[model samples]
Target: MKLVVQEFLTLDGVSQGPGAPDEDTSDGFTRGGWFVPFVDEEFMEIVDGWLAQADGLLLGRRTYENFARDWPAMTDHPNGAIMNGLPKYVATQSLTEAHWDPTTILAGNIVAEVDALKRQPGRELQIHGSARLAQSLLAAGLVDQLRLAIAPVVVGRGRRLFPEGSTPAGLRPVSQHTTKAGLSVHVFDTAGLPSYGIYEG
Candidate 1:
């Protein structure tokens, strides 16, 4: 299975809270719901397509708890079934059991566990909104694909996807498109370490 990381980010690369205002206020992050304005049916259709391609979901502790709390109640939505039924792996040491149906808790070494998971036969093992976990995988050179829905707004402060001095990565663009509400969705395949050279003008 190819390890895929899908994220929602602001123009300034903040990935903290794209859903609701109270969704994630950790470290006093008040810039929540910034991505809401750019979401339309077109974007949702694209998201549904993404959810369809996932054979299973890999989530961090926080993200897993958040989804486990809400997805069951969203059973009426078009994407709810996929969200609820897909096999889920939660990377956490604290959680002894996950109430979410079909969830496996990875309390051991996350990288090794995910590495083993990637070797299994499947389409895509998706990491959805698990930014911290995604960062770890990317740093370890384990992420296979990256799909980001970038909103056209700058959140002056929040947890960013790529902070200063982050591990460098190379991404090759596969496809891109715009939504009706001005969101840019870009898909890329990881290209190992980035190529470095001096440009002689």
Candidate 2:
């Protein structure tokens, strides 16, 4: 199984609280739900297509809670309906019991558990809006592909997708598309040598 990580981010690389203003205010972030107005049918079509191809969903604790309360109540689609019914793996250290149906807390090491999931024979394991989890997975060299929807506006400051302290890896752009609002959907697959290309002469 391949791990495909997807995220909707602002041009300034802010991925926190894309769904709610009060969801995460850790850093005095008042601009939440910035991606809501830009969700056209064309964008929704792209999202629906991706959601349809998932074998399972991987989520961080906060994203899991958001999805658990929202997806089941969202509009019914053949694919979206199936996603709500599939098993979701949540990476959490504090969660012992799940409040939502078909949810599992990762018990072992994050890398080990995700590695086991990647080894299983199944469809692509999809991840969405789990920035912290994605950071760990990317650092461990477990993510197979990245689907990023870069929104138009910039938030100037917020939580970044890639934090400090991680080995560098090469990324090859496999595909690209543009949304109606000028958001670039870049798809990159891990490829080539994992080395810094620039060095002092």
The segments of candidate 2 whose C-alpha lies over 4 angstroms from its true place after superposition are 75-79, 192-201
For this target, which candidate reaches the highest lDDT against the unseen true structure? 1
TM agreement with the true structure for every prediction: 0.98, 0.91
Model 1 score (lDDT): 0.94
Instruction: Estimate the overall C-alpha local distance difference test score of candidate 2.
Output: 0.84
Q: How many Å off is the CA of 84 in candidate 2?
A: 1.3
Please report, in order, the local distance difference test score of every candidate based on alpha carbons: 0.94, 0.84
| Candidate 1 lDDT by residue in tens digits, 53-90 | 99999999989999999999997988888889999999
Cα lDDT tens digits, model 2, 1-201, are 899999889988888877778877877988888777788888888988887788899999888988887777775755657777888999999888887678889967999999999999888888989899998888788999989998888877778786466557679999899988677899999764466667779
Clash pairs detected, candidate 1: none
Cα deviation at 81, candidate 1, in Å, is 1.2
Weakest ten-residue segment in model 1 by summed lDDT? 75-84
